[model samples]
Target: MQKDKRTSLTDGMFLSLMKSSLKGISQVILIENAVTGFIILMAITIFSYPLGIITLSSSIIGTLIGKLGGANENNVNSGLYGYNSVLTGIALTLFLTGPSQWFIALVGAALAAVFSAAMMHFMRNTGIPILTFPFIILTWFMLLASYKLKAFQLSPGLVPQDLSHWTLNISGKVDWLEGSFNGIGQIFFLDSTLAGILLFIGVFWAGWKYGLFSILGNAFALLISFVLGGEHSLIILGLYGYNAILTSIAVSIVFKEDHNRFAPISGIIAACVTVPLTASVATWLLPYGLPALTMPFVLSTWLFLGARKVLPRL
Candidate 1:
């Protein structure tokens, strides 16, 4: 019985970790199981301890709340109710600084859980997945409201990189490659190449297709940004590429199962389209200090998926 108890505890912890990792990609559960999920969290934690802890806390809290509210057992166990909370916590942590931010993190995470449930229910009949809309909505409100309170300030380290010293030559090429890796890491608020490497490994361990698409997505965005004469500094900082990476991976790997020829083509197109769209959207929201979050990915995927339903051949 003691051995059985230990096994059960281990299993429960693994499931929770998987749920937490799934926040990085809502449909990761479709590609990999609990073991892969655990590996992904290990990679994320190894990259950023605070991010890992906050993600785990929010996921567990959301899952518990969802279970108590009599949410579908399958949805709860599969992390459908938890991923948005993880994103909310990560978002708050990334943007806010100081001690009060911790308190806000907790409350924000809880509110995210509640909103996620409500959003999921309201959209149930629409047949469209809510995705990270709950996280986006909650984080936007928190960030906008934080401007009113003096306790909140943006992290000093979150500054844009200065690239006036470098010309778009050999060094630029190196920066782009490193930036591509950083782009993957930035999804979890990590800005290190090591973290990106680990994340790539984790995704690859889950399935090669996931890993491949992630790299492809980052590359596609970089190329598109260059052609569009976007600032090389933002690209090197990985600021302009992360959402496109996610958008590409989601449309290709998660929703479309057949690996249809158009699936990857569509993903590439979405990534290219989102780069300009993200920039344009950010321009409009400049007064709010909002960074567009993952709306580029969310909106692009929604458009593609919705269009696919009608176009069929797409």
Candidate 2:
């Protein structure tokens, strides 16, 4: 009887851990469904097997850290700790090139969880979601560290430039179909066309509402970017669309309360707002050679969410 009880206890614990870890992955896109997480895992796997492994491992590490660290049970169970870790790990891996890339990524993942917890505590009074701020800040700092740290090697793909010497690369027309799909993929730092489509399917798999907002976000951003004379090259690469997609989903569904009748409209406005914010942020970071990352999304979402606290009608 004692052995049987122990086995049952172990099984329960294993299942709980697995579910929490999967929730972490899904939470990357701000969803908490395990099936959605599995589909996203498959999406990344189809792009690069090793990255898929790193993504899952990052989620598990974040989840375990939360559990072992004795964070709030509700927060840990909600997979709050895992999302930033996953992004930080994968971003570091892709942004840095060296023998120590993997080690640094793992370290960054652990640090991301701690940073996330700390940010959550600090931001608790503000009522604004931390969003992906942890990932953005950690990545920027680590990337900058490469200039000083011998062990940290920045990828050749990203280079600092003089803004006065830079010119907009608007050499071609944007492909509407590809841009829409790639927007979703870009949220995970993926540039693969197939991965984007698969990610769209994964988002829709979570809920029709989520999928709808994602499409709305992408479509609005596409039209807005084109109308605003955003660089055609960046549009084609889905750079301008990713932050909008994230902003729409976050404001429209993930954080919307049932009493807020204007959430959908607010989401639309927030999504459109990210377009100019993206351009401004990219230009601001141009001299430093830092990708805007999801800073636009974080800022735009915060703008609307914070305003709603006072405006109430918005």
Candidate 3:
């Protein structure tokens, strides 16, 4: 009897260790993915390149990783949708200044991973509904960095310039049309035309494969924002949509058994809603003398709390 009990205890200890190891693996994967995404974003920004190839490449990488990790088909499919990378890309665009800024990007990525893991833990324990922790953390970090550490500038025009001159290869009539299309598209579509289309495709595909109703929930939220004439432009909306896709993919992989049930849905929603929420909050908070060093931590905490409440419901 004593031997049997010892065996049982050993087995339990092994299981616990394994679980902790798996959690650490997931966190490492998230950080690596974020760093890779930052590198890709920097390449595009500095080299004046289109993001299509990089985006697709990253999706492929994510899908392969999911598959190799014994993720289900749905998880692989969601990873291919490209939402996490989109979040990383957006963060890189906003926060990256030069090669030296890679350290800061790493800091942001580490915090993002912590936020994501804590969110998952909270949702598991508390039965909360969360869908956008990544964006919430990322935006808050950028905002605080901008104000306190001078990590970034508040130039919303940066995206426009990058899209127009560096990436799109537009010139002459093509340039004019592209510029006009982007502007008009932002007013109506919710991002640059290409990004909007990609986001729509990614989200629609995930919804079709998994939860149609949950997808509708996300769509309804966006529609309400649109109808209310929310300040989010098409470009910004596209970014949100892209982030949603990545979040869905990540959740699907991490919570393999529950991929189709609530994980993807919750993750997508959290990612989609976080942008506007953070931006609004940041606007109010920045003027009050928040330090840059604390921004990432604060945002991570809020996201962790919100996710705890939001993820389980989905």
Candidate 4:
């Protein structure tokens, strides 16, 4: 009887271990979605304007369909369905620079949505993990689109002057520290190195409440972009701000805490990135273009306030 009791206790312990393991897996899956969603949103914001609209619309549609079609909240299948297609659409849009690029962007978005749904369906039925399916489909689609699209040429009027000229013009008028501060203040004015610094400051200060992961992720993505020969433009800096806000929202959802202090502090840091330089640059290049220096901070404030409303309550 004692032996039988011992055996039963061992079985119970094993069952408890299994349950704990499953719970941990579920938590990880949820976190992964949060990360992926932020990444996709950042990608869209980086594209901005009409292209951002197309990418966002396609991703939202695809994610909704996947959720309804049997992709669970914390499953690998859901992540693939939601994020992969978004990346594919954005990538296609970037590669297609023709005058007819708008049409091509829409087509790419459609293709990504349809293919993601179809692939998810296939994987579900076969019981295979949908781990790499999105990457495979997106890569192939982008490659095909690139091959078919001809290079586009822009008129001289549409092209901005050399970076050096802009740099020299700004440097001549504003001292380095003052210029950097202004740049921080006007982060959304365009792509500038000062904007990058502000983003880093936001991530760092937010780390106090949300932990180090948010800052680490932003830095990592930035590092990767720099290594890939991408320009450190103001647009890219704006993208980092977008990324940090989304990440903060995600962490709030998962952890169920406000991190209220973190959000505004981060915003101030983001603002600092552009304020000094953006103001000076606008004054020099387009004296009437105050909007250029101010729009990003306005947008960031609006986005964060709206995020507070839309995000699931912790």
Candidate 5:
């Protein structure tokens, strides 16, 4: 009977860890459903098999660190540690190209978990979620490190330019269907139309309301960027849409409190805010050859969430 109990306990722990790792993928979008994460994984794999592997591998690494490091069990199970690692892993793998990129990507993923733990410890009293700040900062640092490191190679798509030479060009026709799907796909650093559709299915699978917010957020961001005369190539490519999708979901659904009565309205506003934020952040990073990543989402979400502390109804 004692041996049987030990075996059962081991199996239970393994199952729990698997579930947490899966939840970590979905948690990238601020959802904690394992099934949703699995669908998202499928979507990612369909577009890039390597990315799909890193996504799940990074999540598992994060969960394992949290589990073994004696962190709060609830936080580990909630997939909080896994999300940052997921983003970090994907970003590093995509932004850096070399034989050692895979190794660096895994290392970055592990560090993301540690970084998230540190951030959580520091922000515990602030009554605000860290969101993907750790991922954003870590990715920027690692990408910048490529400039000095011999083993790290930056992708050709990222080219540093003199601000004096920058020119604004906002002249291209938008592909509505492609833009619609690209927004969701870019969340995982993807641009595949099929992957985007699958991502939407995964989101709706989590909850219809969240799916609605995501669509509304992407649509609003695209429209706002178009009207604001953002570069047509960037707007149509869904560069501006990913941040809005994240902000809308974070503000209205994920971080919302039961007592915050106007969360939905504020959520839309926050989503739209990301359009301009994206342009500004991208331009700021142009000199360094860095993509904006999720800073726009973090900024807009933090804005509304911090405001709600002073006026709880916001």
Candidate 6:
């Protein structure tokens, strides 16, 4: 009896740890691979302590609430239930300062979990992946609402940094490879070159194919943005590139199979469209002082995927 009780307790703890790790990595839209999760957790922690604390706290809270709300056990265990919540945590922490409204972050996380579950149910039959829509919607609402409330003001003194310090390529231009690596790191709201390098390594460790598509996305976005004459500094800082990176990867790996001739083509299209779409969305949201968080990726992925049904031949 004693041995059985000890084993049961051990199993429970192990399961809990696995769930937490999955929730952590789900921030990058990857499933519950603990190795990937550990890398992402380390990346965020190294970037900022407050970001780390809120990410972990909101993730755990979201998971518990998801389980209570009867979200699919597999989804909860795999951390799908917590990904949007993690995004919520990161989004709020990235924009808002101080611990005073940490409670708001927790509340937003809980709502994100609920919205995630609802989206999963609604889209279950539509064959549409509800990737991070909850985060996009909730964060947008929070940002717009905050304009009227003093508690949610933008992080004071957080101006965009000048890009004078980045190492330039031979032509004194933004290095595509460097921007590609930074694009991966930018997913977690990191901007440092080392963070990007670590994430590039992490994705390769997760799956070589994922790494490949990520690089493809980044490069395609960089090329297109340059051709389109996007702001030089923002392009180099990778501000205009991260969405395309994620969209390319998602359209290729997450939504379509490699066997589909259109997979690579769709990825390229997603990358190309990301810059313009993000710029358009940013303009629309500028009045609200709300950043267009992941709108470009979400919209681009949807366009590419939805187009497949009518045009099946690409």
Q: Pick the candidate with the highest lDDT.
A: 5
Q: Rate residue 262 of model 2 by lDDT.
A: 91
Higher-ranked by TM-score: 3 or 6: 6
> Between prediction 1 and prediction 6, which has the larger lDDT?
6
lDDT of 5 by residue, 1-314 (tens): 99999999999999999899999999999998999999999999988898999999999999999999999999899898899999999999999999999999999999999999999999999998899999999999999999899798999988998999889987869997798899988999988899999999999999998999999999999999888888878876899899999999999998899988799989999999999899899989999999999999999999999999898899
> Tens-digit lDDT track for model 6 on 22-91?
5556545454566777677777788787787887777877888867777677777777777888888788
lDDT of each: 0.73, 0.90, 0.38, 0.40, 0.93, 0.75
* lDDT at position 134, candidate 2: 97
- Could you give me the TM-score of model 4 versus the true structure? 0.36
| Clashing residue pairs in candidate 5 (N, C-alpha, C atoms within 3 angstroms) | none
Query: Which residues of candidate 2, in runs, are more than 4 Å off?
Result: none
Error of 2 at 163 (Å): 0.2
Listed per model in order, the count of residue pairs whose N, CA or C atoms clash below 3 Å is 0, 0, 18, 23, 0, 0
Error of 2 at 173 (Å): 2.3
TM-score of each: 0.84, 0.97, 0.41, 0.36, 0.97, 0.88
Which stretches of candidate 1 lie above 4 Å from their native place?
1-32, 150-174, 257-261
Q: Per lDDT, what order, best first?
A: 5, 2, 6, 1, 4, 3
lDDT (tens digit, per residue) of candidate 4 on 84-160: 44444444454446676656555555555467566667755543334324534454445443434554322222233
C-alpha lDDT (0 to 100) for residue 56 of candidate 2? 87
User: Candidate 3: global Cα-lDDT?
Assistant: 0.38
Whole-model lDDT, candidate 6? Answer: 0.75
Better of 1 and 2 by TM-score: 2
Clashes of 6: 0
Q: In candidate 6, where is summed lDDT lowest over 10 consecutive residues?
A: 161-170
21: Cα error in model 1, Å: 7.3
Candidate 2 lDDT by residue in tens digits, 111-132: 9999999999999999899999
Cα RMSD for candidate 3? Answer: 12.7
